[model samples]
Target: MRSVRRTLRTLQGDLARDIALVLLADGIVGVSFGAITVSAGLPVWLPMLLSVLAFAGASQFLFVGIIAAGGNPVAAVLAGLLVNARHVPFGFAVGDVLGRGWRRWAGIHLMIDETVAFALAQREAERRRAAYWACGVGLFVCWNLGVVLGAVAGTVVSDTAALGLDAAFPAVLLALVLPSLRDKTTGAAALVGVAVALVATPVLPAGLPVLLALLALPIAFVLRGRLDEPAHVREEASCPSR
Candidate 1:
């Protein structure tokens, strides 16, 4: 009881602003996703369900985009899985902080990009757990709420394209990717992903282009290793006698 109280207080004071910012952004994007999904001719309930279940923003957009374009469901699922492959490493990295048993299981469901990043940003174990739960639970609630509202709005409206909501999904996706471009490795990976997707789009099926984009992951890893060698050698040379 006391422990839970302390956690809440700490979250309120320290993480409130950060969580609020995420909620606001996520709410808007979630709304866009819902609106776009409905505009694509899917039932409102579909996006609402996806927001609760799949929860990852980029893959969700891809799934809807593919379906909207008359792509195969299998292809969309495969592409979505490919995009979410990063979560495997994310799980390994934060496995320790997730606690044991049921908590671990539940934590896996809550593990998204923002939650993982916020949790890992903390140095202390306690704070890391707190941040993870705070971001996860907060986002889950806000995102779902936004989805419901957007779906409702989408159902009521006609001609979402004229309203410019058609572009919202891609715009949000670009916003998500822009920050990562600050890192040379990520930027290179993104370029490779984009090139592969663009090239494949002309020849391959709709969702298959996204699958081809997965090639960027290994390319990024190899580039990172090669890029680090020079710095490693320089540091080795600069080291005092050891």
Candidate 2:
């Protein structure tokens, strides 16, 4: 416990504060999601089940949104899978922080965009692990608690859109990734992703453009590899002098 506490303390005040703020915002949104789901005339247990089992905010929202629109449940689930396909790459990127054995499985279950971003933003492994678990576990608890509250309240509570709180998560995410954009490789990748997403938005289905944007990552990796090549080796190859 001491070690865990010490590890957590290594998070600078700013990071800890950021995590706290994001958690608060997410809890509010969770309340909104639950209230909206139940108010749409679905069973109260539906949102509770999704919150506990799916634990995916956007995907869950999309699922409920589709169902409320009279879309088929199977289609809604398939759409949720399509939206969540990004997790494959997320798993690859953040796999190191997951450790091994059952701990790894638990980490996998807790993984999300916010937690992964926090883990990636940290340099040290210990800090990465600490950030991942802290954000993931805290978010799980806060979101479920909010869901329960909203479910019980049912029609009494309104969605957060009335308060314009719906934008908090995206704003926080943009802030989290901006620092990473300072790197040449990441910057190139991000620019390409934005362009791809913009271009594909009108043509492709909702989740597909995000997947298409991920193709930008290979450009970053290739650029990084070329950049990492030895200076002398490059000079020799270029000049090929007597």
Candidate 1, 1-242: lDDT as tens digits: 67557667767664667667777777777777788898788988889998899988778989888888999999889888877877887788888878888878878999888788777766678888888888888889988888788888874433446666557545634554476676788799989998999988887645567657778999889988988998788889889765
**Per-model TM-score on C-alpha atoms:** 0.67, 0.87
Q: Kindly list the per-residue Cα lDDT of model 2 for residues 1-242, writing each as its tens digit.
A: 77458658876687788888878888888888888898899999999999999898989999999999999999999989888888999999999988789888888989888998888888888888888888998899999988888887875447577767767777777877888998888899899998998899898767789899888989999988987767557888889565
Q: Which regions in candidate 2 have their CA more than 4 angstroms from the true location?
A: 1-3, 155-157, 222-242
In TM-score terms, which candidate is top?
2
Highest lDDT, which number? 2
Question: Alpha-carbon error at 32 in model 1, in Å?
Answer: 0.7
Backbone steric clashes in candidate 2, count: 0
